[model samples]
Target: MKVNGKVIVVTGAGSGMGRALSLQLIKEGARVAGIDINEEGLRETRDLTGKASAAMSTHVVDITDRERVEALPAELIALHGAVDGIINNAGIIQPFVPIKDLAYDRIERIFNINLYGTLYMVKSFLPALLERPEAHIVNISSMGGFIPFPGQSFYGASKAAVKLLTEGLYAELKDSNVKVTVVHPGAVNTNITKNSNVEMRSDVSAEEQASMTLSAEKAAEIILNGMKADKYRVMVGKDARFLDLFYRFSPKRAVDFITKKMAQMAKAS
Candidate 1:
């Protein structure tokens, strides 16, 4: 569905792709309800909007809090009059360690925020979305969701659940007015490590890292274009696109390739 004049709810709107999505949505004449756990970050996002900030509203709520998430539809509708779309963009990564070395608490935290949080937003906003003449849901999975990223096994598992959840929702809603899209973004330039509160052990220079990933703004643009076209899935970067095809051709080889890359990065760091 076209975003113009629509009231779209974007999670993780404090920064990264979420902030980029908000800015772009407003630029395209859509009203945005930006949600994030960080009030300061939300404020920064709003400030960045300048005069167009009036077209956006910022909500400080953790998607993992069921009660708070449940309350969002009403609050958003009161402010924007209606809800047309929702982008489940808030997520974090696990510590860069093998699953055997990962703690139960850390595993639970990743699942809670990545899987359950996205689920809660879907359940809460779906009814409101259904009320619209046309609506859309976009869930951000990751390249890791479709392929193993050695150290981030659990993070990949959570996003993989999201990938299936979104696809299933598409099947269920195909006959309805609501459209569902699952996005798999390769590495995008964002402070996910800092935001996730996990240290990334990487000896790769900043220039090398930047060369390897898509910018947050560019990723958002591709995602929005996919949503406008009502696509079922979108790969946000060339790395994501290439790896997807490679994995389909030979899963074992793809896994081995990633495993080798992980080992090299580990040794370099």
Candidate 2:
């Protein structure tokens, strides 16, 4: 579905890809409702939109709160007249540790935000989305969703759940007006570690970071293009595309490759 002239809702709009997507949607002539837990970040996103700010509205709400999420459809409709699309971009990562060392509370938090939060937004807005002539739902998974990232096993699991959830939605909504797209993003320049309240190991090299990550603006553009074309699966970066193919042909080798790399990074840090 074309985003131009549509009312699109974007989660995690306070910063990173969410913020970039919101601004880009506004540029494409879409009215956007930007949701985020951080009020300051939302304000910053709105401010960055400048003249296009008139096309956007910022909502400060925790997506994990079912009551808040369920209320969003009505709220967005009131502000924008109708809801045409939603991008579930709000998610957090687990700490850089093995699952054995990971806390249960942390695991729950990761699943709640990455899986349940996406589920909430989709379920809450699905009815309204079906009412539109053409609507779309985009869920952001990760490269780690398919590839094994040793230290982030739980984070990978949460996103993998999202990947499957989105795929199932696509199957169910095939005959409906609402289109579903699942995105696998490689590393991108963002403050996810800070927002997730996890400390990055000091040893991760600058080169490693740069090599794997995409700019948030570029990632947003790729994602929006995929949404416009109504793609069922979108890979946000070259790394994501490459790793996806790598894992498909050699799953064991892919796992070993990532495991060894992460171990080296962990040791260096």
- How far does residue 142 in candidate 2 sit from its true spot (Å)? 0.6
Model 2 global lDDT (CA atoms, 0 to 1): 0.92
Q: After superposition, how far is residue 122 of candidate 1 from its true place, in Å?
A: 0.2
What overall lDDT goes with each candidate model? 0.96, 0.92
Query: In model 2, which runs have C-alpha deviations exceeding 4 angstroms?
Result: 203-212
Clashing pairs in 2: 203-269
- Tens-digit lDDT track of model 1 for 63-111: 9999999999999999889999999999999899898999999999999
lDDT of 1: 0.96
What is the RMSD, in Å, between candidate 2 and the native fold over all Cα? 1.3
TM-scores for all candidates?
0.99, 0.97
